[model samples]
Target chain A: MVYSISIFVSETQSAMKFGGKIGIVGAGALGAFYGARLYRAGNDVHFLVRTGFELIREHGYEIRSCDGDFTIKPPVYSAPEDLGKCDLILVGLKAFANHFLPEVLGPLATPNTVVVTLQNGLGNEETIAEALVKCGVHRSVAEASKQIIGGTAFLCSNRVAPNVIIHSAHGFVRLAEFQGSPKERTFAVAQLFLDAGISCEVRESLAAIRWEKLVWNIPFNGLGVAAHQADTAVILADPELRTTAVEIMKEVIAAAKVNGVDLDERLVADLIGKTEIMGHYKSSMQIDFEAGRPLEVEAILGEPVRRAQQKGFSAPRMHMLYALVRRMDQLRQSNLENSQSRSS
Target chain B: MVYSISIFVSETQSAMKFGGKIGIVGAGALGAFYGARLYRAGNDVHFLVRTGFELIREHGYEIRSCDGDFTIKPPVYSAPEDLGKCDLILVGLKAFANHFLPEVLGPLATPNTVVVTLQNGLGNEETIAEALVKCGVHRSVAEASKQIIGGTAFLCSNRVAPNVIIHSAHGFVRLAEFQGSPKERTFAVAQLFLDAGISCEVRESLAAIRWEKLVWNIPFNGLGVAAHQADTAVILADPELRTTAVEIMKEVIAAAKVNGVDLDERLVADLIGKTEIMGHYKSSMQIDFEAGRPLEVEAILGEPVRRAQQKGFSAPRMHMLYALVRRMDQLRQSNLENSQSRSS
Candidate 1:
């Protein structure tokens, strides 16, 4: 498994003692939030931004957070060549954007830099592992996988404006070694977030962490779009839907168990009960699809369904949702293309 | 089971030869199409229309069929007290609108009336059955069920105008005796359609027929809405969606087996192959949802999923789709209400 890492690169070498030189790639909501936190924590943090670079540079990042409000102006770049080498790289991009990583990481990533993934779904680690060997940055995938850290962000924040992010609820993470045990660097990374008033814990197994997070994502994200942008409260309120959500969560837990991760059934009840209080919160996938952006269908839905099927345990709900989302995404793309052609 | 009877009252009861006085209740697409066919065959057919009663009474019915085009100017009535009793009633309303059966069937339906439901999904027969008993027109539900005919329309048609209906493809039906074996009335009804260019056959049991039709309806209807108004051709064209559809069909068959209906797996393949040539045809449920009308969630999806669960078989796919469609329907309704309030 590859980690969806979102590391921060500090400019001052003296501040590197906390977590070393970090490269923050895919600086979307998650990357920007965490990177901003690290930057404000006396570390030399830099951001590799694609969009809103000018706005962020001019106004800085304003975090209207649930905990407290803060702002930080970090170094920003578009090209990876400008960043040089780093001690660690953190990727907070969406799984759908993982395809463009070769261009983003080819020149910037080195043989020694540790990569951590903070994206949703399965196969990100493997994707990064393969991309590493493909780019000749690393000689072998196994060696590259060893340098990766698995991350699960339990944060709820959105970039409300070009230079502003709003952290609504949670701002915590569960970090782990990617296909390996927790290392000294993992503890060091957790300490950095802990020092910044954010909760971070280093778990032993990456697969367990990934599948556990999927317990919420698979049902919520998939159902949100399928239900025509229904929110968490709406889903919890409807009896049939509420039952269906639980069923899908159970299927995810079953798949995790098959993959050697034992999850308690109580976890489902607890998650559902807690989410009931979430009000009308639209999921990330629902938000993306509604905004006419590409969804992370493969990593979030397809891979999990495929993995379960490979183990001879058919997750009917996940497979059905996967197919629906895939087809919807195709239609959206085709419709967009037609409109673009007409405009052209 | 209550039948959704769509019967037409002939003006001249003395001229009841081909099929006797018929009352066409819920004269939407299926009811209007078949009622027109019967009326053309010299039956005393009268329609009880609600929404388009004035338009249909003035212009009659124009059936633009793939087989051929035809027109009929039938007697129309709004109130059941106006139509009197009929020998046979053919129902063509959606399952969601089955609640209005008491108003439609009270005075027009007699104890001797043969109620044939041409609606989709399960429990329509029961709803109609209970409505008959509640009307005090019948003593028992079982007795009322005996007077009901279970019919599955294989035809594809749409009401393009208030009075014009376009029959695009198939014009056939599988007629069955509800809660009873094939009766003489069933054969007579079959012959009536067979005489006219439309194909009709008498099947043994209503439950078997309903479940068989569901083999196609469940997968297509559920996935179509879930996939954001995807049509038949789009579903068949996508390999993933096609596979998921087949799986759902198989689950329907399994649920049917628990209820003593034996359906072959070859049915799924046959339906898929036949539907592959359907082009971009929207399902009735999809059309209802797009038009802001209620879906047949209880009869089509919820009841089926619940039945399967009761039989100790978990249909995860159907359950998930049920939850999704249910949630989507609720959202649409709420959105409609919000829009109406804003406009007001």
Candidate 2:
């Protein structure tokens, strides 16, 4: 059951020992859950809020967790300028809103600041690297990417209300340096989550972990929405859809291999086997679709398909899924706009 | 803009002159429209009704056509046994309902009866041929195949009420013999439609015309349902979906080629162009999905994908669409059953 990837576990005893000003950007369920853990561990943590700024500032966050319930009224800022510079920045913005990264990170990032992106999908780290360069925090994308750590979260959480988060299950985080192998800071970041009682690991290849996550994400998340807001159980219940999911997983594995990140084909069976026991888990993409929010189509699907196609490898199923999900998102958005206009 | 297929214009002055007892099975919109036309043209057309048996038998069929409006009080039979043997049978059932063909056609079909399936997608003729064999009318499937002629209808019609049909536009039919090249009977069938004031032509190859229709149906119908009940306008409006439709069309064309039915590549552009001017056409599959009816996923998508794969060719996009549409149909049917059980 153990992954072949290298894992670095920091020998540090306390998250507070790593005295760094941590800035939490895009503090939704994933961001707030991890940030609250770090803040509770007595690390200096600040959160940048948007829609629920006033409510969160007045009432703070209520974390209803399966592990244990806790509340943290940590320092919250409405703007990046107010949040100030930090030694570490955690980016959890939806990939669709990644364009605001430069402006948001400009004031919060310094040359020495380590940016950790636990965002889903393929291109967040690259986007962060480009954002850093654009914001004049780094000389080049290479320099910016060096300071960035790409991580994937295996957490089941939802921001039910503006300032309320429900953490139901897994909270495992895998970290890898964006440039190459895990660096000292990568282990430090993994240690932060581990010290906060969250299962954590550091891998050698960012692409490996990302692609591994994608093996699960691409099919489950993609089909979850594309198959009319079907959950994991619904998908697995249908033999054809189950086979389709496996096919999509294989395509992803092949895509990763062609793009220089070799993933085990057994990951398909492993993920499916895990999902079968997971009950009727609605994928985040499916939830977002049901909630009428913009999907992370480009990051999760479009980028991977484009990358694979650039390598002269065709992933037709993935491409088809990308098209369906993207079109669905566009139609939903247009409908929302039309409704708003009509109401106005 | 002329099709290269041979046109068979009967030298007869009236459809009544070449009179044959015609049985219209599956008297849906398409069936009723064509049958009413033939009945009005002084041909003996009997309709086999299901859900609307009482209403249709009482009020007869009211045709509201773009061409012209008419009403016919033709003989309506509730069962095939009551309808008896026919000289010709016009099948306008949905492809998913083909399983009922054996029982339905058992009494209506004789060895001399020519069954023309105007149903959507591939395998309808095969189903009819097998049905004839199973019904003990034809000794063997090969022998039965000769009596089954496959026709693809280019019709825009909907049954608004049980006894009301709205034919918006287009009623051209392309007929081809199921066994091989067009026989004299195929031309006679085309003449039957032409005599009823409908545009009709006979093609040499059934596979060619069927695949040509699929070049339009597979993409438009499949995507129509798959893209969240999106109509043609919604699909064509979205650039990504439009491209996906074209890609699916190309895949269908390729599949047809691999299966020894060579469709022109230009059909892709031609279909898209025609669809552009066709307004917001809600494909039959999309409508069926909206109405919670079973989709023709197997016939329209699954059969073609299987045929192509049997020839060592992969139609990944089509396969993916097939999987999605099938899953959606299953979920919907299950939901309907659950609700019915609860209500009862």
Q: Which number leads on DockQ?
A: 2
List ranges where model 2 is wrong by over 4 Å: A1-3, A10-17, A51-60, A133-142, B1-18, B54-59
For residues B1-344, write the lDDT of model 1, one tens digit per residue. 12222232222321323457889888888888998988898879889888878888888899998878988999999888898899888888888888888877888889988898988998898999999998888989988988888888887888888789999888788888887677566677776776665777777778888898899899888877888778898788889988988889999999988878888778887888778777788888988888888888888998888888888988778888888888777877888899999999
Per-residue lDDT of model 2, residues A1-344, tens digit only: 66456665858522334578999999998999999999998889999998889889888899999999988899999989999999999988889899999999999999999999999999999999999999999989988888999899999999999899999999999888888776667777888888799899888888898988999999989999999868999889887788889899999999999999988777888889999999899988999999999999999999999999999997889988998999888889999999999999
Per-candidate interface DockQ score: 0.70, 0.72
Best by lDDT, which number? 2
lDDT of 2 at A169: 98
- For all candidates in order, the CA lDDT equals 0.83, 0.89
Model 1 regions lying over 4 Å from their true place? A1-19, B1-19
Docking quality tier of candidate 2? Answer: medium
At residue A227, candidate 2 shows an lDDT of: 91
True contacts kept of 1: 0.97
Give per-residue CA lDDT, model 1, range A84-203, as digits (tens): 677778899899998888777787788878888999999999999888888889889998888888889988988777678888999888888896777667777777777777887778
Provide C-alpha RMSD values for all models, in order: 5.3, 2.9
